[model samples]
Target: MSAAERVPGQFTLVLHSHLPWLINHGRWPVGEEWLYQSWAHCYLPLQRILRRLADDGYTDQLSLGITPVLAAQLDDPAAVAGMYEWLADWQLRAMEAAIDDDPDRRASGHREYRAAAAALDDFAQHWQHGGSPAIRDLLSTSVMELLGGPLAHPFQPLLDPRLREFSLHEGLADAQLRWGTRPSGIWAPECAYTPGMESLYRDAGVSHFMVDGPTLHGDTALGRPVADSDVVAFGRDLTVSYRVWSPKSGYPGHGAYRDFHTYDHQTGFKPFRVTGKSVPPAAKKPYDPTLVDAAIDTHVDDFVACIRQRLIDESARLGRDALVVAAFDTELFGHWWHEGPIWLERVLRRLPEAGITVGTLATARRDGYVGDPVELADSSWGSGKDWRVWEGPQVAHLVQLNREVTDTALDSLDKRLPAHGSADPGADPRDLTADQILRETLMTVQSDWPFMVSKDTAAGYAQDRAYKHAHATREICTASDAGRDARAASLAAGWRRADNLFGALDARRLPTRDWSEK
Candidate 1:
């Protein structure tokens, strides 16, 4: 297994960037404010980092998945308003903190806070197009792979067939709207999968969707097809993903990095480190960006070298070329791990230098690499790389909600769907009203809403996003059920104005299965 017979050392790096639907909604926990913070800290910073790389001679290929829910919030006017307000409040909080501490330290905090606030404002304005255009241009040129998912980021397999179909339809359609190209790949909201999910992706025109590595049954290290569907399921290489961020130990646990949880509420700035998760906040070390940057350089080198070795070894062991995939949440960078963006840049830089080719699932599938389809184990990229997080005790309420809401919503739509496949008349208020109600209802059952709620970390934003989506679904259904054509249309239109993510969901695609109890 020499380099000559190892195919092209090509691999795909997929970063899933998503947030629940948070628009003119809540302030703390899960609300519009949370959206702004992530935008300011993660999304905006990440875009800038990529922009810098693109502006340079680097054509290092990367794939990004921005869910329809996140896209909607980023592009919403009310969401922008909430972001601006949050920034302003953050500045005010910093000012107050500056005056209460030692003069020198207080002044330094004030300066840093002001600078952060200004950067946030500028990033917001620069991203007026929801940062969609820049991403689209990158995809168009092939330096970046643009990926999309459902209207509300639902786990299709867990959803009722009807709702699942509608969500995928709308989600794929939304990708077309943002990237100016229909994506052939999908980043399942949680990398959650079941055997029948491949059928749904095929119906939505997706060529591939990600799955956890262990999900691919047996010793097949690369991607394998589920059932007989044309869609390919690429498994995440946990060995690689865990290099930077893992459930137990990763770079984020480094003692020099800024603490995510113990921020100074008075100043709205984090100036400490998690010396030990078990240690009290007062015992943690002072956060130092410079020290963390040094650490990142070391870790980045180790990861790149490790990848190079893995590629070499796998190509040797398999007696054929191999592909390795590393998938992660895009927000982990600037959002959860403050130095994440810096680490990413360092790693990307090292990849090309180390002779590794960056490609997306689109290119991977296109390159004729998929072979020997196998039965995939039902799994997710969660705790234990399985569905425990989703089906765990902490989140049973969410599971119940997912089952009930979807069941109820589908029943409401099914009883009223145009009989015998009657064509929807655009001019008839009742027909238009029904279509919109069914669409919203279908989008609501997306599993992402509740999974986020159950996590408790992003609990605030998750609950609000779920409730808001749920409310929209109910309102539309309630109006339609009562045959209030004009009222239903009005409410439907209002929802569209607030949350028009994708226009592709049709009531006809709702799953027609006997597992209504699921």
Candidate 2:
């Protein structure tokens, strides 16, 4: 019998792929390195698995959200060239490690060398052009559904309404340009929501989106319509998701898995197994591929069982066929967990064989896995399941800066650009001053800065990025407001060279009135 016929419920996996604009930014600890590492380790490997699954005749196995900002970087010429260079450097380092003085380092180096070689070949064969073609190919195969989000992945619940609408429209448009399809669903930046945003989503032609389970008051057995709108809000099932990625417990922490933190300082390779929770880096055992194979098999079985049990339980509890969604950041696979991609492919393949139905969020919605309309409160997937992470006292200064910059940019554009009904408002699509102001403003409002600051992961870098963009926005707006056209043009040009993404952004389309106040 088919999996859907055997099971009383369905399961959907969502992987959100995102990174703030990083090209021309700093490298090393917190910049382009992030883009290259995730590209090489996570995106490449994950897509390969999806491609194989498609060949094996799988369709709608999961939903993949690629933020427009990340998409822009993925398809950018400069970023594409830089990623290739980074992969070449990775191969060189692996070769150096293969010939290291220490036996453990040499063993790790050989493993890394082969992996690097494979990655280089994959890039040359598929990703050399840019991420769009590779992503488009996957979409064309129907292996997964693509989810789009607003420009720069801003916290929409806190964003000004006009900017919120503008960002989403532009983001969907950007996706259409790249993949020739506009996503009807979004990952909803941070899975954050506030009252009345659903109307804006409906207006933008979005049909479905995601939120934390708590945002739906923990009733996650099905998607819910938000506040009388036809748009559906799918909540992540914490029961299944936390099994693989909670703060304290997860499959990646298993003793036999490769330790992501314990690096070989000499060769910059992670050369040790987790061994034990209490074990120090120096006391950890050398990584063994054989151990990882067994560990992955064990975890795959455990996860498959967990999903099967949950589906059965939820179906019985609801007195109807239920839906389960497990969403996580794409970087968790291969990049952070090391064995994540293998585990993912195995779980996806095994679930259906085990009498469990696996499908994408869109499938769940279309197949009648929807419940009642929910009056969702302000919520996010952040700490406390609230907006504190992006609006807390820790990031009070950033919050203030975002508001100030947004206002300055909006006020300047209002004065400079013609209104919607004015004479030939579309006369020029190239408003360098307005374009640059909006660009900087969008960068300033990205949810990453506040998230990093609240979590204290590279807080300094996050703070610097937020303030730097805010400062740029203010300066350009000031120059344009003062009729210093040349100065404003030069500043906009300089900033454009450094922080260029979203080539389709036009300030003329921004709403003249602040709709949030209404």
Candidate 3:
């Protein structure tokens, strides 16, 4: 289709990819497994799909938000090496399963074996060096605009202003180091927002970020710049996003799609289809790749038509060009929903063919999709579309823990480190100490802990991680306050090695006073 004949409405698909600091933390059913599974299934496959589209001259096809914490993991030498080993183990497991006595299990094993082998091969070719190179290659194509968020993916609204500002700056810097440019937009952790956060975003050099549709009072068809700021807040259109995956209904719930929760006890692989919501894992039918392939096509067509009709209806209602943004976690594609990557590839390719103008959030902003400025309320994409999930009774303890740790860390750092000029110029001892404090504080502030605890999914692990980091921060601060320079330095270095993200973190960037107040 000619440029002049293109549709008036724009569709922007935003995938917010994030995981808390899990490296060197734990493995099975939680930490490292989560990272490797996402890496092998989501990141690698999505990269292949986007790279393919970019090679074919698709520009700004989507907006991918890779949180700085996840970026650090992707680029970590330890993580890359660990993932390589994990993939090898996965292949071996598949090989063993392929020889199972049960024909159904054997067939499933073989299918898994092929997938493992292919993922291993792709990892060797594109990801052997580290994720930085792979991601840099994608950025070079400009087919997808990268969106970055604060270090550790903190709930920004509840975070201390000093730490919040520091994390945001450091996070953006991390992205720049890896990709050669800083992202102008961020997927605010959990799509959570508080009033006046936009001013902080503006100061951080961010031009836009995402919030839930209800955060914009449910009129999410157009991007709205925050009051008195150029930072545009793009609201995710639930009507479209939920059509793919939601609590009650979505394509992933189809009987043909791989079941996310049910897994074979012996091999630990999901071997059955989502036969029914009430179906037992043992009773559900075996997964068939062919059936899923057929289902993908059906869902693809359904989604395309949904978008087309949405654009047509929205454009008519607005009497002008409209924008519909569907944002989701990147893990939903290949991790939670096994057929997500294929579905993504088909959707990207089919959207333009159907005359819908697919674009990145950046492109939408550039094309004047910014509607009238408005004051947004305090909101999040969580339950009740508010901050209750993060700060409610279920997780109030975790919230208090975060607040205490953040306050203690900041207060100690301010006292010890002071500012650059105020402190001794020649290799201040407090720099390393301050760095450690911030690192532990950031990790403790990660939104994952509260979310996991609140949802009762891996609650123990989440609580443990949160307290572990908090304890580390407190211990380091205590050592420093006692003037035990040797002990403090030793403890700080040890914790640094453990957390080991944001190596470029500068404690001096942490303001002594709240910059937001100024």
TM-scores of all predicted structures:
0.87, 0.97, 0.96
In model 1, the number of clashes is 7
Q: Point out where model 2 deviates above 4 Å.
A: 1-5, 421-429, 514-518
Q: Give lDDT per model, in order.
A: 0.71, 0.90, 0.90
lDDT of 1: 0.71
**1-518 in candidate 2: lDDT tens per residue?**
56345877899999999999888879987899999999999999998999899999999999999999999988999988998899888889989988878888889989998998899899899988889999889999999999998999999988988789889988998899999999999999999999999999998889999999999888899999988899999999998899999999999999989999998887778989999999998899999898788889999999988998999899999999999899999999998999999999999999888988888988998999999888999999999999999999999999999998888888888888876612354876668788889889999999999999999999999999998999999999899999999999999999998876888787777766744664
User: Residues 1-518, candidate 1, lDDT per residue (tens digit)?
Assistant: 34443334467788899876656455665466667778878877777777777778565467788888787777666666666666677677667767875653475477667756766667555765556765665655556777788777676666766666667776777777776888888888788887777877887788888887777642434566668877888878878888878768888887777778886655567778777778788787666655776788888888888788877776677776678888888889888998888888888877866777666787777776577777776787776767777767776766676676666566666667544332343322344555566655555566665566556667655555556666777777777778776887798888877665445545554444444454
Candidate 3 lDDT tens digits, 1-518: 77765677899999999888889888987889999999999999999998899899999999999998898898899999999999999999999999999988899899999999999999999998888899889989989999998988999999987788888988998889988999999999999998899999999899999999999988998899998999999999999999998999999899999999888989988999999888877799999888888899999999999998999899999999899999999999999999999999999999998889999999999999889999999999999999988999999899899988887887677678756522333455438887888898998989999999889999999999999999999999988888887898899999988877889887866656644564
RMSD to the hidden true structure, all candidates: 3.8, 1.7, 2.1
TM-score result, candidate 3:
0.96
The alpha-carbon lDDT assigned to residue 135 of candidate 2 equals 88
lDDT ranking from best candidate downward: 2, 3, 1
Question: RMSD in angstroms, candidate 1?
Answer: 3.8
The C-alpha stretches of model 1 lying farther than 4 A from their native spots are: 1-8, 88-104, 107-111, 114-125, 217-221, 276-278, 384-388, 391-400, 420-432, 458-479, 486-518
Weakest ten-residue segment in model 2 by summed lDDT: 421-430
